[model samples]
Target: MTDPNQSVLSKLPNNVIDEILIRLPFRDAVCTSILSKEWRKHWCRLPQLTLDSDFWKSKKDLTGDKRATSNFTMTIHNIITRHSGPLTKFTLCIQYWEIYPPIDNLLYFLSRNRIQHLVLKLPRQFKLPPSFFTCLHLRHLFLQNCLLLPPPDFKGFDRLIRLELHEVTISSKLLESLISNCLLLEQLVLRISDTLSDIIEINAPMLKSCDFTGDMTTICLKCVPRLTELSLRYYRKDWKEFDVANFLTSNFFESCPDHLEHLHLDYGVIAKGQEIPKKLPFDLLCVKHLCMCIYLDRDEILCPLSLIRSFPFLQYLEIQMEHNFKKNMPALECLEMEAFPDVIFEHLREVTLIEANASIREMQLIKLLLAMSPALVKMVISPHRFLGKSTIVKTLTKLAEFECAPKAEIFLKLV
Candidate 1:
């Protein structure tokens, strides 16, 4: 039999249970209400309500009214009205279809509620409301593929700590003004398309990390005194330059003057016809752990050995490509249909290559590795294939024999 005292404590006050459940993912938390009458009632009073419907597939012939939008809106409203305190997080992610509820009404409801974190994720064409910028209590905001109305001047909250913009295009100047106004901002991730014009200026003093994925858009970051981590993932042929001399430059790198430890850069360039091969820049001094990935298409070429040698303190290096390796051509040769820089890899502790098809070019790369990087402790080469475990093991052994580097511990990923 259940202890009466224990049962009484287990069935805590409704507000306490609701607050606890509010922290959970929306669906899981809502399901808890099904356990008993008490829980069912309390779930409706949860402060944080989240909806991620990417898994919900729409029927080909269903109309908007016949879908789940009406119930979803009703349930959300019921939960919000039942809650007495502010919401900690509110997320709504809808993918795979073109169905949506009223955007204006949703924004108005959220604006009135004291929400600290808000996430909006929709597939390509969903339009967002301008009133979203008026949220004064929001500290974390994430938008994916939702068109944001350009703020007239940057009058959002000073309490914002993290802002992630994905698949949306806004003027760099307006974005810069917004960044400048977020004094307490920390992480800024930009996954944008090409409506970007002019340079983005970021002036958050307490910013600690920054991650950007897109074409090289001009950016200016200022007053980042304690900044440390940075990740740049480039998928196109746009130039992203960092002027070390400018104060805004410090926002991304913080100059690492007091020992900035981690630095990661994954970039790819697709060269166009008649376009001049550009020298890739790797100009930094104090990075302890560095990961640089460069992808060169048939028309794009890699930088010179002199340029690769510029990084004096790199402890790790990873170079990946999608080509036949037997040709023994330089990775950069494909980009420019030309030769590669002189080989130089001395200080690297760990080196890795990914998805190279041709075995001959793989052998040449290993030969260069043996001659250049005497200090390399580990080397891994992996092919791009999906097969059984036995087949993968056999392939690994074959590739290892083809470009064997005895000096370093080699791991061949044949699968």
Candidate 2:
């Protein structure tokens, strides 16, 4: 019997075979060299290489080799040296804890080859080589647990589009300088960096998406004229409190770009005595999609409602609910009376309630939104856990009885 797989693969063009090999892990793709002489020739031409730490660890476990770091370093050096084509993408993740692998040589080779996409996640903070910053052809760069110290005369990444830094130690001034230099940069993400304690300021005019998740006293969006999506997850540390309302009210958001559309705010963890902002500082009239992940406590609930009133153009709303069922729902009538008269979500078409148990308070809020949003089209209620069929039916019946929009549809989803 003839093997159809081999027959089909044999008929494939060399370029198609190279494409397939490029998508596979470096180790697996290299192993295909044993399949045939043609495959061996095609594999060497692959432009993408992903060297994951887990693969090296598994190899070490199988071979019982204590010098895994040395082996990994040598393997990567040999692979880079033997490659026949221009390297476009390279990812290296080192997991050996005993010693820091020599990455300067690898980065130098990649830089010389004009790599376009680069990702490095080292076990410890490895100082980046100056050659890395000079990779003019690089477009996407993601570094985790690395030290970045750009030279004083650092001419920025001219063609870089997306830059992500996680647990990287870079000063606010240096980061701003680096971003200011990237003329064509589009998206920027900073996540949980221990060194970022100062007031962070972003001034990218061409940027479209910005996301920050960490502890910062203040964040100022200096001038992101083209920003359409913004996500912020503030983590409170010690007794120092950060106020979201103040940030929104600042000149930064007050005169925020009109192009902004998507906004996501998550209050990850608040201190015992800390207080969540009661009201948004400025109206999000231009925003169309809004997501709020907050505790369903007295102060937190009012903020979302206030935000709903502020963003009159909001088309989609997603709320992640968190609260104690043992405690009674707070008096929301006062808030409703104060905010509901000004709130008419005429453009809101979809509402999503996540981690909901269909409790009385949640039902009330849903009903309130349904009544307010005259153009509501769909309401998706995703419960925290599965419920009995009878319970689901009852819940649906209750929802159907609510005075919703003329064409509103309700769906009960169990998770």
Supply the global lDDT for candidate 1.
Answer: 0.61
Task: Name model 1 segments beyond 4 Å from true.
Answer: 1-25, 45-47, 54-68, 95-100, 108-113, 123-125, 150-154, 221-225, 235-267, 272-283, 296-301, 304-307, 324-346, 356-358, 387-407, 413-415
Cα shift from native, residue 300, model 2 (Å): 2.8
Candidate 2 Cα errors over 4 Å, as ranges: 1-11, 57-66, 95-98, 193-195, 236-240, 269-281, 297-299, 324-339, 386-394
Best by lDDT: 2
TM-score of every candidate relative to the true structure: 0.74, 0.88
Clashing pairs in 2: none
User: Number of the top candidate by TM-score?
Assistant: 2
C-alpha root-mean-square deviation, candidate 1: 5.9
Candidate 2 lands at a TM-score of 0.88
lDDT of each: 0.61, 0.75
The residue-by-residue lDDT of candidate 1 on 353-389, one tens digit each, is 7765444444455555545666778877675563346
Instruction: Put down candidate 2 lDDT per residue, 1-415, tens digits, no spaces.
Output: 8667766767889788877887777778888877755566666677888877545657553343457766767787777678887889888776345456677778788888889999987666778888777777889999888888887677888888999988887887778878888878899988863636566677787999988887644567887899999888776445254555555445655646899999888755544443445456667789999998746654556655665667878999999988666455645563453456766888999999998766666777888888889999999998766446676677788888888888999887776
